[model samples]
Target: MSVLIKTVGFSLGLTLVFTGVANMLPQVEGDAPVDVKVDLSALTMDDFVAMGEDLFNNKGTCTLCHKPAPLGRAPDVQGTNMVAITTERLADERYQGKATDAASYILESMLEPSAYVVAGWGKKGSDDAESPMPAVDKPPIQLSDIEVDAIIAYLQAKDGNEVTVALPSPDAAAEVAKSDAAPGGAGAAPAPAASGEEGLAKYTCTACHALDSDDTLVGPGLGSVGARLSEGEIRQSIIDPNAVIAEGFPAAMPGDFAEKMTVRELEMIVKLLAEKKQ
Candidate 1:
């Protein structure tokens, strides 16, 4: 009986020790990836261009790799004219794919990135050169066709080039909305905002704008925006950014904030930014 008691006590002590160790260790949690969906039916050509500019600067992550200035990793978008580049590339014997025009060339670049690997950017010594650029329609980016159209429009308009594609009608967008409501649809509802910081992170505001410093990243620093612009102007900037762009910054603020942000979330962000006068 004494032996049995000793064995049971030893087992209990071991179990307690294991439980304590488990509690002391850090807990790691994995979150499922969120799908982003935007309804573009109601947006006009101007709206699309604006949204595209936002995606380019933020969600699209284009600026992370491509820059206006010449860099070793990726091509410079600002210095070169895309229309002229596309026309010239079509005449190249090394060029592959069915892109016949400037618009198609841009579309092909996004869709089939590996089709034409730009010189010096491709994988070295491989029989078929591979491009570092991932397909924008695939994972990590997963931009919708409407979003793609908007980005293309942005690229065209930014250089003062002619916009070749027309935006879809509102009725067509309504049809898309209806289809999305059906079983196994691609569309997802907007994410809930827990706080102003979460809302800013959700829309990827930190990717371009900085709160801590006056130095610009992609957009103007918001460190002193509260001192500069009124609350109403700040609110307008969130929804309609191009209305008044800050000096020394490109008018590339995303125009989809009105659709992406809830009224409460927008107010929360605006209030937080308004407090950043210093």
Candidate 2:
């Protein structure tokens, strides 16, 4: 019995050491959360355009598919003059949309992506008729109306064209910011996801990574991810995706989840994914 007690004590000590070491690691991934609150006082064209640029690269997730060839699945917004392209698109017989000007074209193109599928940018096997781009005002990439307009303003300004899109009224913009704002700030933020399933739906992870079944989407199957990756690894993939690109997929996961997910919400989904061992 003395020998058994000694072994038990040693095992308990080892358990405490492992627990302490785990707690010593960083809690939040990357830096402190970037407060995306829009400055209501600074509603100038410059500010709005800057916000648009930020969204285009960050929240908007446009670069995922809009990269230059041969990787780009969408039209390269940077390489080609989008303003000029909009002009030609409006004139094209294939143009089924209602936007007659650049600002409208950009807005319409985002919300009504299928209205004008750029010649070769359509979804595969659709004969250039279907677009893979989701509406910016909709799920997973829910940019508010003001946010969408901000993108148009940015694009126009970036192309050296006049910013014809109207700046959002302070009151109107504030309402939008308020609804999505976290506790402290009145900046634009994603609608909250209260549960693990809600988070998966909000971010639409199942669109690419499967929750169950071998029938995965575009990205690799994540059905048995926990059996494969540790909880820490799953958390890292969500927060700092590019840190370790999953073997067969591009470094295409968004790098801004650290900002989007609340700590509890993040842990909820992480726990859910970590249990996906089947």
Q: Candidate 1: misplaced stretches above 4 Å?
A: 1-42, 70-72, 124-128, 175-278
lDDT values of the candidates?
0.68, 0.71
Summing lDDT over every window of 10 consecutive residues in candidate 1, give the lowest-scoring window. Answer: 24-33
Per-residue alpha-carbon lDDT of candidate 1 for residues 47-139, written as tens digits (9 for 90 to 100): 778878888876687775587644323687645688878877888888978898988998998999779877766533433366656678865
TM-score, candidate 2, is: 0.66
**lDDT at position 189, candidate 1:** 35
| Tens digit per residue, CA lDDT, model 2, 216-278 | 234556788889899988888887888898876667666766665555556678889899899
TM-score list, all predictions: 0.50, 0.66
| Candidate 2, lDDT over the whole model | 0.71
Let me know the TM-score candidate 1 reaches against the reference structure. 0.50
